[model samples]
Target: MDNVSWWAVASALAAGCLGLSVPGLLATLPLRLRPLPRLALAAPASLALIGCVGVIDGLLHLRFHWSHVLIAAAVIAAVLWPIREKRPLWSCPRLSALLPVTASAVSSVAFALVLLHQVPSFDLFSQSYDNLFHLNATQSILETGNASSLQLRTLINTDRTLSTYPAGWHTAAAMICQITGVSIGVAFNALAIAVVSVAWLPGIAWLTSLVVPQRQRTAGLCASLLLGTAFGFFPYALLIWGVLYPTFLAYALFPSGLALAMLLAHVWLPRWAPAVSDQVRPWAWNDRWMLLGLAAVWWLGAFFTHPRSLVSMVLLIVPLVLWICARAIAVAWKAGGARRRRMLWWLGGAFAFVSVAAVAAILVVFRVFHVASRPVGDHLNGPQAQAVQTVWDGLWQVLTQNALVGLGLDMTGSLIILAVVVLTGLVIALRRADLRWMVVAYALIAVLFALAAGSNSDMTKILTGLWYKDRYRLSALLPLLGVPLATLAVLRIAALTRWPRVVALGSATIVAASGWAGLWAPVGAAAAHEYRLENVKTTDFVDSRQIAFMQQVADVVPADQLLLGDPWDGSGLSWLYADRRPVFPHLNGQWDPDRLLIAQHLDQIESDPAVCTALRHLNVHYLLVSTGEFDGGDPSGNKFAAIDAAVSQGLFTPVLSDGESALLRIDQCS
Candidate 1:
């Protein structure tokens, strides 16, 4: 990596650490010493740390390109520094803060262990199609020294055409590639295993602080630890599917945005009952403005990083804007002129900032990427159609069977159940006129928006053809969001009952148990099955065979050649091999002529001499086929029979085959 790049990454990390750790250090100060201190203290410390890291990277020769790490760290520091002094740390005595930190540390360690054990299995067989695109983009940039005109179509042999997928993710990876000059494998491994998890931690901490009360701060901290570790640390660590995709990063932002929104709402609402004698306070506006600012930042990040997330935010924000408007109107109607003026200013300012930020993001993305929004359509057909059905069924099973215990990682149903539960909690809380419950409701809606936006179906049909399947259900976030709300509910219920403490303890136990069961039963089972059946050591499946065949094809094809194939087939090809771009016939409801040529009538292409001539005319170098028959009926039980006959005529050469599938190299037909 260049000196500047190294400096950027190093500085980012240093800044993040300094910003996050400073609050804990301040918590050690006496209560009297903590009142109205200079908020600038944390900011300087974080900036200084970033500067130091940059200086060290420039001066010292650190082998690994620490630039991306530094950039991410610095970003975190910049975010946390301003809020550090303003937000109250849990009012714990010196030693008390250690308990939550300890809990978080333990959970982090456990999460690391789970990830390490599962990495080998996930890397070998599971399709990391998104990572392949990143690698392809990075390679093209490295070779050509230009980001634009670096074609994705040439890398994978498919006719789906380019422009369906966004370039931002690839751009980020290419930036990393420019610095490290390492294999794509190493770069992706670093991103999936480390960068994403670290980036998520601070937001998790901030959200935990918001949801957990002052008295139960330690437990809240523990809850954050549990949420982050359980949902993010453990599950993502064990599965290749979740962490490698941009959706994971985008989904993480969902909670952060929701938390900030809730905080803003809390600040805007009248703290005291509306009465003539009620006294107004200066600090009342603090949470409102702080939250609005934070929400704007999160929205911007989500927009640039992932489009699906941006879509989800819109769905969530519309309802919230209406809610805010209603509350503002209510406050204005009842309050005096002076009070009304202040409220209007606060509401207006908050709205303006958020609106500006969101609009700027949309315009920037469109301009930089040259993305044109497309309409959504029903794309699931054939095996994919069946897969979608199974996915839906699986989701339903998750909700019904493991509502409280949760269906664990890779289960969409758990997420749905959790959403339902949160909604139910919100309804109960709202009926009882509890402010906290309303906050949770808003948070849940925001999270749902993020999830829907990041969803594979949404992305494939709308933003880009990049799909991570059902993993985007984000069951982990459910637990993270649920724990504190459930805890509070338990506490409230206990307060009203004779056996309040017992009930509270019982509820906590049930939740923890449910979490443990969810973690172990279905998610663990799926992971274990994947590990046992498809690990690098053991290869015994159709997917593996397909992957190996595609790898062989990648070896022979020129780095710049594009392969045209079926959408499902193309995804598999692009994912398994580097520098091979597959063009699917239809992506995000758009069809490309080049992709259509390859997808049309393989059976006819095999039998007709003229079709071979036409294929060669189009510069088609090879044809790949799996076991299944094409749209036309098999010439025999074997779909490749007529293709085999064509090959025997010496027009095409059989380059590679695993007995079941084959790659036929196209030669000029004489």
Candidate 2:
């Protein structure tokens, strides 16, 4: 069969397997329970198993041995075994009551996957180092037959190993790769789509169900759909998936953490039932245990999958823990002796389980990887730096110009609006003023975390300190907490108006529309591709003329020779020539003083005659410079002008020049 047919078969197989497994997993839950609740419990466990297996295989390089398979089976059995011990079944309100929530969850996942698949895949560029490290680690684990001493890096110039990414995401990708025998690209794509559908969507749905009243369930469902769609389907989501696939995988686990936190919060509060109401009694011990287990899975998944997201989770958890503590205290204060004792038991059990799981995750990350909490520095350049400068401007632009109409159907603006609407709705719905105050506090924490992490400073230091900054804006996941509250607020507002239902429905519609518009922009008919990366082909697409000239130089250079150039140019060229490793590829967050020294010396060798002579002694093959691109408009004003001048004055021979980039070969003394 042709490659196309092979890929088609693989795609079909992946879809079929996931479709069967997901539904079966979901079906295992008590049928009487709300769909969201079942998903909230099941999705995280499934994703955790998937991720753990992947990290083991990808980072540890463990083979798909029978032992590994047995471990996975054991994990699955452990999670599912509890379901077999049947308890008295309680009746829920109705399946019809959950249709809106279920539909919204399903629709959000479906839309995200469809949109993601429709986009063309791009060659992994600068971020491929992370992928390579993960791949290498997983391979090493398999080869050595040792999981415990699975060092992530082979070469360590820095204090941290180059492969020191969180093990969870790599393991998940590795497992998927092992199962499918597909390339990393396909494995990541499958995992990314599944992570959202299974973990994120369901988590959002469950959070909404727990908080929103039955009467206002539709609005809550709508709000969730708005937030999930806006956040999960943004352009950045696609960009991250295309370039930094693992980070995208980590992002998939983000929603699950929030869901777990919210689930725990609900258990603590046990919303009051009216005297006349016939709703079931507050959640039981078994239910609380189940939520705790699910929470544990999410928290573990967050830490393991992406260290960066772990930072974000740390930021979120502080307020969450405080809220839980306050609720427990309030319950104990108001309750009679026996009831107070029971509340204490519940609080202790929940906190102990959560605390243990958190500590275990920390030990795994720190002890296993030997990662230290260090101060931030130069690694803070590029998109993050740009993001810091533009964040305030972007926020202002969204609020003033497009608050009502919304910045038409693009991911970034839509996400900002979704966060705003959800927060507004939640604030309005607070039955207790204290709850409102807690929400405000959490929101403040999230904003502060985002500002610090995304700023022009070291994200790692901020994240190491905060822990929650790891996932960046994943605190946006908390906006989901406000979803239920917002629904009630809408209903309450509508009640004061003549056409209550219309006002509520209309308001929801406007919010959803605005969100959808912001995330899914209309592409021009003549646009080359629907997705940004798809517009350019990997085989040939030059963003800069200098890049094209550099490629030409690469064509003439021998495979074994080293060519030095600027950091940005070197990165793109290295990716293009599969066999070549640039003297310094753009730092992959693993660089230290030594690596920095190497990079600086390499730069010096490329530009300075004395340095070039020394580099030749060390066996440097060629020096490449793009005088035109480097100099604003005049080649003479370029940073490499001295090198160009020296080469002209018989210091080196210019072998090639396309009026853009130039290649110089140093003459050796015989």
Residue 585 Cα positional deviation in candidate 2, in Å, after optimal superposition: 6.8
Model 2's alpha-carbon lDDT is: 0.47
Q: Best candidate, lDDT-wise? A: 2
Could you give candidate 2's per-residue lDDT for residues 494-543 as a string of tens digits? Answer: 66888765677666556555555554542111011322322222322223
Q: lDDT tens string, model 1, 1-670?
A: 1112434434333333333234323422222112111121222222223233323442453321325334545565565555455446545557755655565555554554444444343233223324335555455544444333213333443334333333333434444445545444444434443323444544455554554445454454454554454442223532443223555545545545655555555556544321111112344455455445445544544543456655544444454556556665676759868878887787789789989998987676455434655323333222211132234443443233232111223441243333344455455545543343345444553333233333435333333222322323333344444544544554555557776545544544454444444454445444444433231212222255565667777787776655534433333244235346444322222333433433444446656566655555455576665553222332224322444344445555678787755776666443
Task: Assess the local accuracy of residue 339 in candidate 2 as a C-alpha lDDT between 0 and 100.
Answer: 75
TM-score of each: 0.57, 0.60
What stretches of model 1 exceed 4 Å from their correct place?
A: 1-98, 108-120, 125-196, 199-201, 228-244, 263-294, 314-327, 336-480, 489-510, 527-542, 545-592, 601-620, 628-651
